[model samples]
Target: MSGQDTSEVGHGHGHGHGHGHSRSRTVAGLLSRVGHAIRPHSHDTADKTDQALEASSKGMRVLAVSFAALMATALVQSVIVAVSGSIALLGDTLHNFADALTALPLAIAFSLGRRAATRRFTYGYGRAEDLAGIVIVLLIAASAALAGYEAVVRLMHPQDVEALGWVAAAGVIGFLGNEAVARYRIKVGREIGSAALVADGLHARTDGFTSLAVLLGAGGAALGFPIADPIVGLAITAAICFVLRDAAREIYHRLMDAVDPRLVEQAESILSGVPGVKGVGSVRLRWIGHALRAEVDIQVSDRLSLVEAHAVAVAAEHRLIHDLPRLTAATVHADPDGSDGIDHHAVLATHR
Candidate 1:
């Protein structure tokens, strides 16, 4: 027994069966993280980026269909703007066209995200989706700037907008097109757990509201108050800036590896239920594209053999995957249950 190897486990500071910590995370983040923990990939097959790639296919299909609809709407609005010389219609046309173009970078991102992992980029190209989010934020900001500028200019030099009825109709058309696209993108984005797609959908929703502002302007101009057009455009600009701020925040959280606190709770619950686990340690989760990857530490009895400890860890991992269908990969660490447990800090430093 003295010569036989035994595996000991110990927990780090804070997390234990009795420890309480503030959790900051969303339900979406929680579910995604839980999913990754439930469907863990073994360390030997960690390079299986195919799972990530296949998940992005749904987003691509959504982008394709939405792009076509927006393009047609923009084209129609641009022709009307050119013929009518309505400053208000011009703002709406530019916004519709700009919003439509956003799908370009997003499309590229989804394609890149589906690529297999490489040695230089071991995590694969999933972060490209976050980069696309930045692109979206910028596009939204640009639209806001353009709208504000046009509104100020129109306010200073009020112009008699021609074809008031047609301008009014165009505004309604923009609203309908944007609303439909928004609903579709948001629905699919949620289904696929794509933050980028969801953000883009929010952007479209704001655009739809701005389109209605164009309607207000058209209506006011018809009633002989020409300044109403630019006023609505200014209002639309403010709304766009609001959307930009929110979308950027969500992407920032992703880049920072922020996951919902519920995921931690979910992980701990499963680890605690494992037959050999004595105490659950730290559990962390993050979204890489739409998939979640989980890393957790568990404490086992000091008396357990090295093989037994490893088996316990394996068992915990299997249970996680069995419980959550969305979880794709997990890394579980087993520690000896006591203060005299293996000095992981020292061992980690040695490995580093």
Candidate 2:
């Protein structure tokens, strides 16, 4: 038999089996089972778990607050570095500016990502946040490159820096500010599962460490090792580059529709455990921002009627959605047992 002929026979047999199994569970029974399965967990709070909007709003608020704090520190740090003529402190100030730029996109993304699902876009705009994260990573990479170049130039021709005491004190203040912002954003991001916020938080925390390095470099320069200032700048640039590379990889996976393997296994286990399903044929999953879309094919008895087959498909879909909270949509295709016939070929041809 030709490849197409074999596929036709297989599809026909699967459809026949699906029809036979559909009658096992009525729509009402399936819905009741789904309800029971989907009941809220004991740890869920009435106020917090009820609304996506509330959760998204809180996430945006946290990010906005963190951005404001970073901006304030950046302005102070910039002024201090300019006065002290400290190359290390100036490099840290530029890092803060890049962070501030990233924050604007994050704020815009959070505000728009919460739009309700529409007819054309059933999943809304949640993925916009993920896109914003990608932008942040790119900006960090650019900043690192720029900083590295400047550090190399400074190293080639070292210059004396003044006002060492004031510059060090400003560095200390910047570090404290960045630390507080980073911790707050991280806490809120985890609570709301906001990737953009988490990325921003991590960026801020790194800035804090870089600020401390600048303070030390400024002190070293004052103590006669003038090259320490540019050397510290080079170190900070390397660290930022590492962070950018990691974030880019994560963003790439999400954008390319790579599903979490664990999630796929969990879904397969749930379907296989359903009472009447004899075998599973194929499963596919993809990510849509924070949510997942799943599709599955299953086999059932060939003697069942069309109505019976539909019921089985419904039951399977309900079970999948009920057990998997992250799944926003699912499609189930039913097949029949060993009744390979030419009619199945026609069905496949029509869809193709």
Candidate 3:
């Protein structure tokens, strides 16, 4: 029999199995007696484009709302800073403003991600989100440097903080605004599987905590310790640095194409359960933007004709698409059990 090859792309749907299995005995079936264990995961693959578009829309809304909220929070704190001359409040306000502005790059990214794939960019514009994540990290670093610099300068030249009550109120406002934005961003980010959005949310959460530190400075200033304002400023800068570290690390992992190991195991289990599949081979999955694509290899009987093999391959691929979440495309290769006593991989063994 000649070798058969097949490729398919599917969005989540179930199809009747056309090919018959002759006393099927797959490697995966013998490995466990507990039966198939599938976790609860669902995907709206029927309308993939619509799903992607909706995710982008959600991201845009998050950016818009968060930007406006942070801007308003900063505006209120800026007025307090002018009247009270509190360096801690000033640092917190600047961070809030910077945090809000970071949304611009992410908005652009979401817009770019919505564009259809072209020959020059066959993978589409999903990686733009990771680039936006890089921009966010840089902005965070810049905010930290500025906050730290201002604190040192203020420490060298002590000054009394006026309107302590207003400064305290501004801190409360900042915390409330930032915490709300953080929760919303994180919730939507996980839903859409957008790492950049989640990182941005974490950045907002840190800003909220730092805003509360402004209250400590106001309390110290009220107690006759003028240096407390600058000290609090430095503390806020340290917190920003921590955020910078976490955001950078998350972006790095995404850029490196890191995924959960459980996803791979789950994919293998799904493929092995398919009828007519005798053995499972390499199963590879990767993210192209927010969605996932898979490549798999399966062993079939050498006695089967080329058409039967192709049908088996298609069946395996169909099973994969229906089971895996966010899996838009999959390539399944069917390898004969033992063809003419020849080793197909011997040609490439030397290279390895």
Query: Which predicted model would earn the best lDDT?
Result: 3
For candidate 3, the TM-score is 0.85
What is the C-alpha lDDT profile of model 1 across 227-265, one tens digit per residue?
Answer: 888888788778877887998899899889897888778
Compose the digit string of candidate 3's lDDT tens values, residues 219-308.
999999989999999999999988889989988888888778899999999988987788888888877667777878788777665555
Question: What value does the lDDT take at residue 103 in candidate 1?
Answer: 87
lDDT of 3: 0.79
Error of 3 at 27 (Å): 24
Model 2 poorest ten-residue lDDT run: 1-10
Candidate 1, residue 30: how far the Cα is off, in Å: 32
**How many clashes show up in model 3?**
0
Tell me how far the alpha carbon of residue 240 in candidate 2 is from the true structure, in angstroms, after superposition: 1.1
lDDT of each: 0.72, 0.70, 0.79
TM-score of model 1 relative to the true fold?
0.82
lDDT of 1: 0.72
Ranking by lDDT: 3, 1, 2
